[model samples]
Target: MPMKASGAADLTVVDRFDDGVGWIAYPDETMQRASHAVESDGQLWVIDPVDAEGVDDLFEEFAEVGGVVVLLDRHKRDAAAVANRHDVPVYVPEWMSGVEDDLDAPVKQMTDGVGDFAVDRLIDNPFWQEAVLFDGETLIVPEALGTVSYFCASGERVGIHPMLRALPPKKLRQYDTERLLVGHGEGLSEDVRQEVRGALSGARRKMIPLYLKNLRGALGI
Candidate 1:
């Protein structure tokens, strides 16, 4: 069974059985490709709501119990429709908009930088506040190679972010992770720093050849 985080129930990836490599069902998980769920402030929060009906089913069930939908960043793939349908307002990062629209029923514009989107907790680094929640436990996804992690009760955070450059000492101090929850990319784990190091190393190596390649042979010179 999926877990709950707050006064409400927390949904999680449970029972990935033979339904074509699918996880167990949330109340109506056909949408949001629903990944994880958590409880916060006496409300049930659902993350990454997919367009599928199963996701909707979960939302439908939760709506009756007062569940709040939060689309972290622009990841509002299927949250818009459901939010409108149930009259449940969806929360989004301020940097993004139109990401979730349910006929102007209600929407919370969120951002890590401005407005009510400001982070709900404190962090060692300023950038860490840029971290917002789609559904409380769910973190705002910045971008590919975007360093995001989980706010574990035991104080653990982890995620893979593309390392375009080395992080400052302050940012480095903020890195405390345990699992890489979700990403569009395939084959990545929660060991963020290590994964980023490897990706950065590869990205840097690719750039070297472009700067010093021989043009004569067009192969290797």
Candidate 2:
């Protein structure tokens, strides 16, 4: 699907903590693709960034742009453009495959992590290879979990990706995260770790129901 342009005025801030900020450049869409600017060691790491006019002003708090990170294989959203603008390498997790060839900007492969967050491989298959970054306090999940309506059913705070609902990434529950940031939608901050556990534990149980709900929405029933 084609995406629209978002100028400075079109941007809406979603998640803001002491060291990171998440914004939605396309707020009107269902996907509500979110981008983040996380500060670690005085360097700002832009994750799955979608370019917006004057968006650079949001990064002024940090001394310099450390890198642009692409956590999910398909979420190369504006990384090259953003990296080129800041003259930083677009950092791709070393374990993630089939992504480096698509990038135009300079590429730096991260073996362990970027900044204070440690990278963990969540999904690895021929079709999809995703990674999540976390420090004890903040969890940045590029996919496999989200807060959008499509991702959740009734009474769900966070949810597994519909495709992975049958076998959700249960290991995410191990993190004692205060804030849960995602690539697709607004994140969770209040009681986030509990919410993540709930989502994972209930994913399989709710799969069929959620699929029917999505089907109804798609059919406008």
Candidate 3:
């Protein structure tokens, strides 16, 4: 995927809900790198943020920036820049390591939860460490699941990450997710439970075909 800096003109607001708004900063990129600003207790918590020219304007009605949250190790994606801009610390889950070391802005390790969302550790290997933020109503899955075309299968609205499809994270199946927010593409508001369940249930069954499909796409077949 091509990585390029985006300006205000490139920002596209998506997944606008009652509690938060998501923005795609790099829409041209294959990844469709998305960022979220969730309002809890009158404070806006930015997640996996990608800095854009007028991102601050979206938070105007949501109250002040509570803090910036980084859910996955590699998704540092302008977190520090956004946190520093708002004068809030970058909140990394306590279990997630190495991410704080990479940030230039102030870092605060979250122990129990950040704002109203509780941290649920999804993957914890040496190479990848990720967690999802769930608050009974909203589910912010950073990587384990997404709505992007590359992440989903033939008729799926949400799909397991290609790397994790073989042995999909079963822990995610526990939640009856109402709203699904992700780091890539856009968030899902309708039929979230059905979409999430179908993705997990069919993940392994669809793995081989999906992998070959992605490989073909990569080779421009």
Candidate 4:
């Protein structure tokens, strides 16, 4: 909930967590610790009291001084497990609560459209308030979600995470994206990044109509 020291060049490393929430750790690649950072709503959030073995190091590096927030871009992943552990509220779009059917992990939700809610202090005002970052701040996102496809039994449909891993250049020209964080899959690798970005971008556009249709029928709308 506070600020991290001024190590401005640190890039959170994106790693896969079995639980599905994206993990980004301090720049230290040597850390084989149970560490993870999540990009929720738009702010950077890290998990504390990390797995038993790496608890001390993980906690030391993760302590914040101010202006930190936890964002949960997808409710389906059930991220509250980590959010609750840190005693932080989860960020979400206003439209999301209308459709985030999962209840177990629900926490305080907010969006860029809100008139007042400490929104700016908590997250970036633009980018759907998506992919927020601050000096010495860290963010983790499912940068690959947009490209990866999965079958959902409940909705009987598939949807994308809206942001995918990709090169900063091509992604900007192709999407005119509001803003997003790199969560998983091949970070800083131009070739792998571009491929994943293109795939996810294409998939997200395709999944929109389908997701809406399925959600509408489910809600009787």
Candidate 5:
């Protein structure tokens, strides 16, 4: 069964790994987004915070936050707010140095990858940027992949977010994923490997229309 937040009406434990790593969902009208936390050495590390109003209360329920990681440049979201509240450092991708100007807390560049965190950068994307974080047997993806439905008694559905499907496939096959933690929609805890393979292989055909639409917007045509 999924875990529930004490006082926060918008937060829910959408996915929990076997080692206590989990992600919370904050759903709005248009999309259901998520932020991840990992417990290691009795400390918590948050990734891509959302809905700042109840962050402190949420953190109190979990372990004290020691750090924050921003996986995508555009996904700064509430990282700075959470970092400030906890007096922790924020780690961002090196290429996205411009984000430093927008953040209020001390920022560190993840130049050599997040040490010992098992994160791998998905190179060769033409649309946007992101990294895949591996926590034990779980795979936490920032974007380019995610679920678009809610977890139900039947099961959860996994897919590539429409915007990211435009990009080519990454080196995702190398990882042996048991569970998937996404930044949007519901997290997948069953049949993860097959779902990922389906997204990587079959999404290209579905991407063509959206890719053309994006191209038109870029050209203002």
Candidate 6:
């Protein structure tokens, strides 16, 4: 699928935490794409950034951006553009080494961890590859996990992302996740751990159908 251009002027702050962690969402057709910024050690770090015209003003409100981190290879999104503007390094997961030849900023390899955050490869699929970020208390997931669909028939809009349902679940029960930050949708502030487990359980049974749907979506059929 072709990448969607970011409507930066349409970006808005959708969620904020007490620790200066914030999630921003920008329109992309009928759905919205999201990114996150967190304050750590007096600097701000952006994850899966989308290009925006007011990005400088946004960063100024937070602290100076220290760096940018890309969790999924396809999610490089506007990381290079944003990093160049800030003159910061762009960190990509070790698994995504050769996918960034077109990036303008300096790229660094993220090994087992970066700063105080640890990486967890949650999906084994090559096409739908993703990793979760554990920052001691919060779990930040890429496209592999989302709370936008009610696929589990829960009435509430929290469940596994359709594209990731075919993948087996990772053992994420150990994390004391107080907050759940996702790349494509809204963040969850309550009962995040339980919601994640529910999504995983729901995925196992609905895998086949979800896989077919995801494949069609990817093929734009």
| Index of the highest-TM-score prediction | 3
lDDT by residue (5-24, candidate 5, tens digit) is: 22354666656553444445
**Candidate 3 error regions (>4 Å):** 1-9
Write one digit per residue (lDDT tens) for candidate 1, span 1-221: 11211223233444122110112233332121334334344444444444443545543333242323443444555555656665666665454434445324476654442221224322223233223333222233333233222111111232223222234113322334333334232222356556544444444444333234323223435
Q: lDDT per residue, candidate 3, 1-221, as tens digits?
A: 56444454388899898889999987878888889999987788999998887899989978789999999999998999999888999999888888988999999998877778988888999989998899989999999998887898888888999999888998988988889999988988888988898999999999988888888988989
Give one digit per residue, the lDDT tens place, for model 2 in 1-221.
Answer: 12344444378888987898889887887787999999987789999998886579888876588999999999987999999998999999898888899999999999888888898988889988899998788899988999988899779988899999988888897888888999889998898877888898899999999999989987789
How much RMSD separates candidate 4 from the native structure?
Answer: 13.6
Residue pairs in collision within model 5: none
Q: Rank the candidates by TM-score, best first.
A: 3, 2, 6, 5, 1, 4
Q: Candidates 3 and 6: which is better by TM-score?
A: 3
The true-versus-predicted C-alpha distance at residue 154 of model 3, in Å, is 0.9
Q: Estimate the overall C-alpha local distance difference test score of candidate 2.
A: 0.88
User: What tens-digit string does per-residue lDDT give for candidate 6 at 1-221?
Assistant: 12444433466675577544544545543345678877666778888887765656666667778889888767888889889988999987777645468677898877775556788876645565667788888788877666543233344345666655666455666678888887867788888877777777777676666566656666778
Question: Local error of candidate 6 at 159, Å?
Answer: 2.0
Question: What is every candidate's alpha-carbon RMSD to the true fold?
Answer: 11.9, 2.0, 1.6, 13.6, 6.8, 3.8
lDDT of 4: 0.33
TM-score of 6: 0.82
Q: Tell me how far the alpha carbon of residue 83 in candidate 6 is from the true structure, in angstroms, after superposition.
A: 0.1
Best-performing candidate as measured by lDDT: 3
The total number of steric clashes, by the backbone 3 Å criterion, in model 1 comes to: 35
Off by over 4 Å in 1: 1-35, 56-74, 95-104, 111-142, 146-173, 183-193, 200-203, 206-221
Runs off by more than 4 Å, candidate 2: 1-9
Could you tell me how far off, in angstroms, the CA of residue 10 lies in candidate 1 after the best superposition? 22
On a 0 to 100 scale, what is the lDDT of residue 19 in model 6? 45
Compute each candidate's TM-score over C-alphas: 0.45, 0.95, 0.95, 0.36, 0.76, 0.82
